[model samples]
Target: MQEEFISSKQNAKVKNWRKLKTAKGRKQQGLYMIEGEHLIEEAVRSGVYLEAIILNETYEGAYPTGFSTYRLAAHVFESLAETDSPQGILAILGAQSRFNAAEDFQQLLAKPGDAINRWLLVDGVQDPGNLGTIIRTADAAGYRGVVLGTGTVDLYNDKVLRSTQGSHWHIEVVELPIETAMQTLQGAGIPVLATALHREARDYRTLDYAAGAPLALVVGNEGQGVQAKLIEQANLSVFIPMPGQAESLNVAVATGILLFAL
Candidate 1:
């Protein structure tokens, strides 16, 4: 490995790391930082392009071959890393397409009608961690794709990427207007189900998973729950039952349980 060690924190690339701290930089530069062998390897296997592979000076081992490689002083690498205890490697990957339901959700938008089914829609789900975890769980359960609505968290945020644990790459994420999403699914004979916190809501487990038709699972904002209009549009309204003392399951946890149950 050809190592380039820099002592000055002001080095342009180091400053570039700071830019990644904001959503704008990530969007404009079309890059995001991910550290650790496991995460990078997952990205690599998914064929996500690496803008650069930056490593600590003392690093050793035959790593993958495909991109620029730089070795900063171990201390410098540690200083720039988002987490404690640097893992001796970091990678800059060009920005990936995130799930936006309204305008740019390519997977479903481009596919033939037969390919459009089993979507997971979100409305104003602002928490990055929660959104990412939901995508991860949905992928594990073999859903078709995700439709992200207005006010949802940035899908490419580092926190979301980390929370997804690599599932982000496997599924499709589209940003779309909620109305467009509903219309798209409804036109294709896919039924929409919105989760609710109300008393009369059907228990999630009791829903007919075998409806055998394409289904869309709609999860709403954290505090506001699903919007009233969405509830009115859904073919079914459901909720997770709780025998425990907690008021409700966190959005991601509840979604996972429901995904598995259905």
Candidate 2:
């Protein structure tokens, strides 16, 4: 592998690298940038399509071999970095489409080995950190996949990606209309439960089910909770009873608790 050195920030490649830091640029180019050695390690281990790897001249850490590599001047590297303490390594990776078609959803459900029936659905989860934490928690809780509804934060946002800690590669993430996803799951005989604080809502712990039965859990926006119309469509509405003085739990924290329960 040849190591190219970049000294001028005005170079076209350097300008493009800086552009990828924005959402518009990422969308236009169909690529996203991840920094730090840990994320680069995760990307290498997952064998995802990588456009290139970049390093600062002073970096002495190990990096994956057999890929396009570049060494940048310290000032040039700082211009492209978003973190205070840069690990001196960054990677540009091809973006994957978030849309998992309805047919593909069914195909995943009908797979031969390890039928995945448990799903976590998010409706208008706007906070990047919250959404990322929720996705990471869903992965840890062994959910089949995450369905992101409209009005949710961008899945590929830098903050979200960082918060996930590479959990995104471990699980499937699908962006689809909440109503359509809910209907599809319900038609497949999976129960759709919404998390809400309503008089009619039941305690999450009281849910009755077989160990391996198909289930879907819907978590909503941080400020408003689940939309009333969506909750109305749910088979049941459940809440984590809080007897303390706090008004409500953080959406991510509530999601983790409910995911483990259901």
Candidate 3:
């Protein structure tokens, strides 16, 4: 394994690593940074391809072997960290292959009849926390995967990654257009259900999800809810019936309820 000590914040490698904090940088470089020992351990446990393991000069913890390691000066590590209380350990990894929309979508479609069971389709969920929570919930609920539709926040965003608490490493997540995802699932005989409050919508509890058919649940933006066009394209629309007086549930909370119930 290669090891290096970098004290200069102006080092070319440090500059490149700092770029990973932005969407454009991550896209351009096809790499993203994850700080904290838990995240690094999760990545290692998941057998993710690690480009390098980075440590604050003072970090004393042991990390996995057989990978390149870098030790950064205190100031340099602080400047690269996203969290106020940064964990002394971090990792750099290649972006997951599933982020390629077209290829991953085709692979989902190619699944042998009903092999794709449950999926969470996210549409324009702007909040990183909400999106991350949804993904984590989906993983816990035994869903097949998550398809992030158009306008959804980037899955690699640091807040989203942090909010997931390492669940992202445990499940399959892909990006695709909402319409395309709906059509593909429907074409494969799976029912697509959109969460919305409309005249035609049914109570979520009333739905028959135990019929052994594959299912896909669509949750949308925190404010706008699911897009009108996507809702229309769905096989059905479902809404949670609140007994108490409240406008609506948070997208993440609603998703947990629906995932567990269905």
lDDT of each: 0.79, 0.88, 0.88
Residue-level lDDT of model 3, residues 1-262, one tens digit each, is 8779999999999999999999999999999999888888888889888998888999998887888899999999998999988878889999987755565676666665422478899999999999999999998887878999889999999999988988887777888898888887887778899999998999987887674457999999999999999999999999999999998899999999999899
Once fitted onto the true fold, the runs of candidate 2 whose alpha carbons sit more than 4 angstroms away are 112-115
Cα displacement (Å) at residue 113, model 1: 10
Residues 135-225, candidate 2: write the lDDT tens digits.
9998998887899998998887888999898888878789888888888888888889999888999998898877677899999998998
lDDT for each residue of candidate 1 in 1-262, tens digit (9 for 90 to 100): 4556676667898888768868898887888888778888998899987888888878785566657787787667777677766678888888766645443444455475533357889899999999989999988887767888888898877778888888877877777867679877776677889998777689876767673456888998999988988888888899887899998788998888887787
Q: List the lowest-lDDT window of 10 residues for candidate 1.
A: 99-108
Off by over 4 Å in 3: 99-104, 112-116
Query: How does model 2 fare in lDDT?
Result: 0.88
* Global fold similarity of model 3 (TM-score): 0.95
Flag clash pairs in model 3.
none
lDDT of 1 at 136: 92
